[model samples]
Target: MDIFERKPVNHAIHTSPSNDLRLVESAIPDIQPHECLIHVRATGICGSDVHFWKHGHIGDMVVTGDNGLGHESAGVVLKVGADVTKFKPGDRVALECGIPCSKPTCYFCRTGQYNACPDVVFFSTPPHHGTLRRYHAHPEAWLHHLPDNLSFEEGSLLEPLTVALAGIDRSGLRLADPIVICGAGPIGLVTLLAANAAGAEPIVITDLDEGRLAKAKELVPRVRPVKAALGEDAKGFAGRIVSELGQEAKLVMECTGVEASIHAGIYSARFGGSVFVIGVGKDMLTFPFMHLSSREIDLRFQYRYHDIYPKSISVAAAGLVDLKPLVSHRFQLEDGIKAFETASNPASKAIKVQIVDE
Candidate 1:
């Protein structure tokens, strides 16, 4: 241990049973041989975090008292344990949210599908505390050193960026492919960037919120933006997308987990085209599965991500995509409650609310 180590006190933002967030001080963690302690600098509030705050659960992950809430994070290393060679104190880094079982016998790990490992432990999900804290200790293997070109806020975005990349990767999108992306949330916006990076052109992006669509257009002027009217059914939106783009898109990446949006993406894809679903929504959705067979529309689902941190970092460092526009709001560590309040309110026009430790 460094003789001059800072006093081992940490503060974490966690949710209570009443769906309110509170900050509490706790002991800083001791690093394992393969781990490092990070002084968290920035973390973005994800849609799933909002779900957990509003409903106290997402899927099966419940936010009990002990559950700290945040997963997207970046920080500076405070300490590195013995035997750790990849990083040391003062290194800036981004955290990969999922930690999988390292056991070689684990089927998913051996198959290079570690994200699907049955015994995986993900941050801010149910029993696991997350990265919304003053300090955190994480495995060195899961941490990616951030280059000087990327800000801490941009580094935190790598988690969502990887999701967008995974969607494109899953779709097997070809260059210049006509694509439609539903939901102009963070994931959708990043998907637009990923598509642009992949050489996809004349992409159409749809959103119920005209503000979000306008923001998307501002970011990517070449994108075709379509605003879905209120009460517009999936079929109706599909027709609008076809009319806007002059033909069904070759691929539709559904970033909104809403049932109607999912249906629209599926219905809007060209015959034999693929639809990649990247959002997390309700478990059961009423869908016309039979239509898929007649049109040969390939429906693919994506989980979090695989080994994509390095690529995401490189993409940001190269300036291929600018992620700074997505962060429309920022809050200090002391303003935890207000931060969640603003993030949960659509009226706030908050695209991505970041909590920063000053």
Candidate 2:
């Protein structure tokens, strides 16, 4: 049976102007010479997806029309383009949502920081459509082969795992080095797993929700979960984290974009330590400039991942970091609306909500 002989009906989940989700039928995207057509098997709903569905925008990027949602995805190659040499039909693969122009003239691309490329087309961001549908055409270079050990659901998680990997890489984390991570959301939990696998000692994760903290502890038994009080200030919360860890951490990964969390991360770090911000938050935020300067705390920001998918896949394939436990809820593609609702509701306790095609 020739899978490409007849095109399949493609249904995509999109965000409507009424602040609701609508599953709409979209045409199967055509593949370019350097691209391949994918039969999307699994796609994880990111926090940004829910934010766009409920608020109609994220920061400055507003949803203009019925924009498709989802970026963390994996699929099987249904068809390969004429010039595509690395992949073929029936191969399992994971999609790297960002496509950067690899032109030699582009400094960022030339320097291996293609994620910072100005001309990069990142899926599901603003005008660009996403991979929530049954079929999508992606560049061959950005599609990674999934090992037999990893399921499509686990493959879909590679994208977020790369974010965790990138955070660890940017922080210069060392073996047995103590660290603090803010927020127990999917990103933070994955960071905990990655940090643990990297042999970080006495990992501390903070969150306001006890359920999320408990989930973190369940995922990594050695992790210390610290609950933030309702009216706790950054300094007080930082003190709590320090007391939990027995000392100030040399590195803090701020996975929650909340301003308070950012401040707490800085305050929790020892003098001359670093704080790596991995979350997306408000555009304009106030920080303790004088304190940061006086303490010589190096604050860095992490953009989307670059050249980390293969390493992330290897980590999952080797069973060093189990990605399955991160999935708290699952739904079929037809139930994408319900999936979004579950992800947006705090009461659902959904660490990661995924839409599966099969």
> Top model by lDDT, which number?
2
Report clashes for each candidate as comma-separated counts.
0, 0
lDDT of 2 by residue, 315-349 (tens): 99999999999998999998888888899888998
lDDT of 1 at 85: 98
Candidate lDDT (C-alpha), each? 0.89, 0.91
**Model 1 global lDDT (CA atoms, 0 to 1):** 0.89
Model 1 misplaced stretches (Cα beyond 4 Å): 1-9
lDDT tens digits by residue: candidate 1, 238-338: 99898887888899999989888888888898899998889888967877799888999988899888988888999899999899999999999778778
